[model samples]
Target: MKAFITLVFITVTLATYAQTKYSNEFMNIGVDAAALGMSNAVTASTKDVNAGYWNPAGLVNLEDRQLALMHSSYFANIANYDYAAFAMPLDDRSAFGISLIRFAVDDILDTTQLIDDQGNVNYDRISLFSTADYGLTFSYARKLPVQGLNYGVNAKVIRRIIGDFANSWGFGFDAAIQFKTDNNWEFGVMARDITTTFNSWSYDEEAFERVQNAVEGQNQELPETTEITIPKLQLGVAKTYTFHYDYTLRAELDLNMRFAQNNDIISTSFASINPALGFEFGYIDMIYLRGGVGNFQNELQIDNSESLSFQPSFGLGFKYNGIHVDYAFTDIGDQSVALYSNVFSLKLDFSIFR
Candidate 1:
């Protein structure tokens, strides 16, 4: 019972904090090992099914039906993240895509009933529950008459659940544009939650009564039930080069911008910007190696001194007969603050059937 009360307090505190900053953060964790390997720097050069989550405008480049799946674990496997997406060209210059993402922590012990009404400790009274977040995105992209420009939009629905105790639903929209230059340079812009996302929460009062009674004057009232996610933007540029006839190299840089100042490398009262860089090397378009560095932040050390930290990721990919298998070693934060996780993803190009 004590543990359960503590958990409730922590959950409520985190929930309140999230309402003002980093709301719906799971959606930003990203999908596809190929992008994660590049520390999420593929905004300008993403041209596959995974583009639905990165920069949907790139989907217009698809020539055939594509399906992608990815799975990754975080926090020492305490949490699991999964993604699936499908995309197909609608015509010579248009495309459509759909994608789903889920992040969850399952089988958490419910200690609220550790003790019976008679004050008797009963081991069998414990139960389990899960907390999860889900996002569904519908995307559309079309090539514009202006030379190499393409534009896309996404309608997203979000669901959040906390073991039947609480739940919330949200909706948002995103817009993006991708342009390719005659000189092989690509530029992309993604505006996430452009109109702002809103989540309305509902809690079961009966289910929360236990938490209310667990402490005096603590959690006595339900938490605020509304959360707002502000708009964010990403700008990217990429270029690819081919040498030795069969060797190809691609490099991309992205600037992720947030409306409010934070820990990003470039911080201001109006906006904060974080830069990411990624590189991919391909041999005969079959075997590939990738690397990236991003998520730069200033950390306060034990002695109150500030130090710069960043995350580095590496990945490998293989392609054969329209099948692509990729693996990535990524760290959400500096090695000292977080552990590296292994991610695997698969992509299938249906054109192989033809």
Candidate 2:
């Protein structure tokens, strides 16, 4: 087991090295923080739950105070993540909200190299590496009763810190429009990551030294360095019909698209049409079941003629009072079980101000 873990560490290091810093590291994190993450979309217009994270326009329809917390993570050794939020309405025309999210990879053994004057490699401190992502957000939504539509905007300032190496500060804003049909068919459009980003490499000695060197062979580097922006656009539609008094079947479809600055990276710009179907039969909304599959865009054959493909994912959750817990599983086969990874998260939410 120890050897397997060590091998995984090496593989992850090299895999991350081949790509850019922070590549895909934060991609799968913070998903379980929202029940919507479990079903791609949960009863969207219900008070201002974490559902807002998936569709900002949903905030416009909230009626009262709502708070939520979600935790989930994966990998063989386990990576931890956290997400939380609160939202409410004012004057029957506007709403406000705030949120927090985190990503942490713990117990990572730091490699060390010691040298005796000759600058030889020597193992040193047994440390770990970690990173966290958090954002303070404010949002407002106005209802146009004449058209039965809602238009909203959200502003968030984000901070990303990675160990002692890199830190970044940026601002983002999202615009969303939502409206429902006469038959209660809801539709929403949202665009995310529309702000500029700058990563503070100076926060770390090692990363800064590398930047300085790159500038040596060229013109003076800019005072503040920045990375490319990754933007995501999504269109969502959902409809629900009562199966019983308090029981209902909710089906949602989201056409999600994320594009990177580099066009040659064809995979980054591709879109995923995620269809999630869920059934909620709770008497007082105390429990839920959610299952969905995504990331199955392509098929590939392994090196030796064996074929490998992206696997489907499923999750389950239960809620009581104001707290919730969830778990997700991905099956990639027995040999690939170690890489399949299981994600588990806990959510905490409650109403405080009526």
Candidate 3:
């Protein structure tokens, strides 16, 4: 039974890769508890090391060398995700950042050997393998001549591996801009995979043969080896309000747009747009609370009725002397799927050591 299930899993995974949509999805899962807690609505307001992933243009706001780390588990602990980032000012007008991300499912039982050549069940032959994806990003940001304006770009490399069965390599680029007004209003835009990322895959023939033989006539041939990811755009607006001298509140809204039509809130032949809203409350810039809602979708019910669904997230944060600790209770999918996960992240300023 276990071997059969593993075969089915591999078949489904390969099949999904044939489609262009949602390719390299692990990279979109996001990083940092604070950003995830805000449903990734920080494109216009991010300013720390995490900006290397969110909106590199915001890196211009960094005043000191910074480092960040985060970890989270998904699908009831069946998968794990990890992220790390570092950013520093190159001068008064330019900044540089680098980030790394990994998502993996480990210790999967490779039950191909569960049955001996004599067709007898033998648990002793079972082995373990893992499937993992990795991303490395290099980002650069610079202040423009126009006051309160900045531009940034990212060069990314992608790696994917399925134990000893298959592996792939990919490359992509991203561009972004951020602007701040004297009235405290902020705006930002980001273009992901602006050059259309491409992944080329290679398979181990012997291992693939085992997969094909496991399911008669089902996996008769190798799957498509090339995958493409199109461009995606995000636009954001934000503002901060101060109540008295110690209390503050920040609100942000973002529109995530994809060229192909889908189940998003606003869908058309040309594009689909999903809107996200987030808010943060701070006291003396030390303690914080955050909340957000996003991922709007239209789903068909069992009775053939249509319904709307969304994902909600909340978070808490504390900062003292350049150290920040954040926690978020969030859902990766919509309410219908209910894949909730706990995320934690830490950020530090190198200036603290000096």
How do all models score by TM-score? 0.96, 0.72, 0.98
Write model 2 residue lDDT over 203-316, tens digit each, in one string: 555543333332224222223344444556667777767655766555666555565432121244353343333333333465555554433333335653534333345666
- In lDDT terms, which candidate is top? 3
Q: Which candidate tops TM-score?
A: 3
Query: Which rank order by lDDT, best down to worst?
Result: 3, 1, 2
lDDT tens digits, residue span 1-354, model 1: 556664674357435734464478999988888888888999999999999999999999999999999999999999999999999999999999999999999988777767777888887977888889999999999999999999999999999988857889999999999999998999999999998999888988877776565444665467678788999999999999999989999999999999998888888999999999999999999999999999998787899998888989999999999999999999667757888999999999999999
Candidate 3 residue lDDT tens string, 1-354: 778899878767776677555478888989999988899999999888999898999999999999999999999999999999999999999999999999999999988767777889888888889999999999999999999999999999999999888999999999999999999999999999999899999989898777777765775577789898889999999999999989999999999999898999899999999999999999999999999999999888999988999999999999999999999999779976967999999999998999
Candidate 3 wrong stretches, greater than 4 Å: none
Clashes found in each candidate (C-alpha, N, C closer than 3 A)? 0, 5, 0
Better of 1 and 2 by lDDT: 1
Which RMSD does model 2 reach against the true structure? 6.1
At residue 251, give the lDDT of candidate 2.
60
Candidate no. 3 TM-score:
0.98
Off by over 4 Å in 1: 1-10, 13-22, 215-217
On TM-score, the stronger of 1 and 2 is 1
**lDDT score, residue 9, model 3?**
86
